[model samples]
Target: MAESNKNGATARLRNYFLAGVLITAPISITFWLTWRVITFIDDRITPIIPPQWNPESYLPFGVPGLGLIVALVALTLIGFLAAGYLGRVTMRIGERIVARVPVIRSVYSWTKQVFETVLSQSSAAFREVVLIEYPRPGCWAVGFITGTTVGEVQRLTAATVYNVFVPATPNPTTGFLLFVPKEDVHHLDLTVEEGIKLVISGGIVVPDQANFEGAEVDAAAKAQVAAQSDRAENVEGNGRKRRRRKQTQEPRSPGFITRLRNYFFAGILVTAPIAITVWLAWEFVAFVDGTVTPYIPAPWNPETYLPFSIPGLGVVIVVLGLIMIGFLTAGFVGRSLVSASERLLARMPVIRSLYSAVKQIFETVLKEQSRAFREVILFEYPRKNCWALGFITGPAEGGIQELTPDDTVNVFLPTTPNPTSGFLLFLPRRETQILSMTVEEGIKMVVSGGIVTPPDREVGDAAEPEESTPAPLAKSG
Candidate 1:
């Protein structure tokens, strides 16, 4: 009897502990998320807020929630204004302008839908929570019934469909809007609020649902990694037992170690590019300051007047000096002087070759009309049917065109990971394929080894031909 009493006490203690945890966790998470949101808004909105309008400007110490409060008021005010006649007309005009832009139109429409679904409290918006397969078969997700399909969509898909919005976990703002068939949808017993809560909690904190029995739906859904075994499971038809090949247990949340690793990688992703860019910029400025600062005229230098040294003074001086040189070089006297200098340099053997090469490189690069490495083309290389990316430097004139054919064209086939060095091929014009990708995009693909790709464009809808006025590489002596 004493042993039984002790066991009962132990069980009660465990229940009490669990109940305390159940109460504490949600409250703690809610407060943490709230703080995070407030700070994030403050960081962004604080800078843009005028000193006169911002209350923190008057205070000695910075206030945190000022920006958040401002943001709330601004959004509410905007909403109120949007409902007015003038604001509505302005919005419609703005939308019309946005709709004219092909890419922006798609993005705007999608963004508008997300806002409407999440914020709208109308009868047609998120009427009820539902269950549907998403991403792939057997992978079920909790969704909200945004609306029923209409017009083109209903006509195109020969079935009764509902516009189901499956909100991503941890963030209900952005997610997939699936046009799910009505037959596939399982009307969950949970409310819309419960569904949203389920998503925000990352499938944790599941509400007790009486739609489906335990151990049966898990086997049928063929559950995946996500902790979706319980909440995302669909109801069985007519309470029939499903014949199952596999009976897997509910997937658990990621362990502490996994979460730690993910956080570490995420931190690296955010910091790496910023840290590298800052370091590189600093190094470049320091190099210029060390090499060129001493030579700069005292009057021209800003550091001479300032009490504290400026970081990018050398860079500013260099840019101004280049602009001045360019202006001087455009004059008739400058041209005569340059011609005389070139004639003198042409008398040398090695010096002439180097100077000629450098000058030609600069001229070609600087000239807007010179389409050197401007056009992206494709041609067979090494073997037939095997293609390669090449830039059209110019026409295959001189001996190469004479020896081959009148239709021959010069192509520079760039290598992967390094576009500095490449093979030069002279092929027939008919054999080459002109691609829609620009030279910049081609270089990017080459540098990244095909990791980054340019979006596909229709062949017939390609831009104008690569050649710009007076054919390329036909330079006058």
Candidate 2:
């Protein structure tokens, strides 16, 4: 009896300890990460201040978050300078000088454009969340409406089309671009941030009930689906068909082994995402630190004087260095030097070709006005029956369009799971089937290998015949 009582107390203690760990671990890690970031920023930025001007120099102890405040102020000052007419003139002259260089021109131009687009508040990069049907009908995906098709693409298509960017799950930076008709896409009520979260979580973090219900396709699409379903039912006698009832498994008390397995799986599901996120962040910081820390002068380096290594000092240095470079490059003297350096690189045979190609691609995509990944599309590929998810890059112009008699569109067919690499198909516009799913949904489907499907709607409800009232005829008589 005493042994049994002792065992029960031990079990209770174990459960309490587990519960405490679950509660405290996340909070502890979060605080630790925040402290590390603050410390890193302080280490790099604090040294820049002269001893007389520094708060730490007079204070009994060092203050946290002072470096972050300093960094913000520095960025604001830079922005204020860039906004002026003199700054604008200086920037243009620098750009012209950089453009004169062959190899460096490519890298600098691309980097500058990317930074500008990202930093620009006016840029509509990923605002409108949309839905698109991907792979085939009955399957849908979420995506973002990037913009409308422009240049050669607009001229070729009879219908007004939109550009959709379908980003892949876990890492949404990569995905397909599809050109879909404006009428076909189902717009979602979810915001851009919410959509990103959904993509990263692999559909586990869905929106609220109200938001989910509000995500409806166009009324015309509903009618069309209903009509199609009606036709299908008519062709294959509805009377002969019966709905298959799904069997529900009976609930039973779990055995010890079963309970243990369930608990283990639950623990994994809870911890894995947090662990992976932290690991990725840590590795990124480490990488930046590794690359930049070695370059720091021994006298200026924090690690040289300190007993322990600082975590994000290199990251802070790298950011400040980039900003300083940008500031310098905006001036006349900096541009001339950069241009001279680039001209020397251009003399290299193999490097020039690679540089030019890369530069062109960056300029095309990163330009604020350029609509590159504009639309999500469906095209029959490999064979007639086999359908694939693709992004409409643009109209097939140049030598390729001249070869084909029909009006052709350039479609990038991204492979399942891994969307980074895919086949580029030049298909006739008439042969392509435009879908209604958004790029976000499309990416989720691709990442999950068709496991994560969009919400189902009843298609044939409107098509069903209603019973006529016989009383109305009698009343008229």
Task: Determine the C-alpha RMSD for candidate 2 after optimal superposition of all C-alphas.
Answer: 20.5
Using lDDT as the measure, the top candidate is 2
Q: lDDT of each structure?
A: 0.61, 0.62
User: For each candidate, what TM-score against the reference?
Assistant: 0.43, 0.45
Runs off by more than 4 Å, candidate 2: 1-18, 32-52, 56-62, 108-122, 217-477
lDDT of 2 by residue, 161-202 (tens): 555667788888776555566555566667899989889889
Cα displacement (Å) at residue 267, model 2: 45
| TM-score result, candidate 2 | 0.45
Q: RMSD in angstroms, all models?
A: 19.4, 20.5
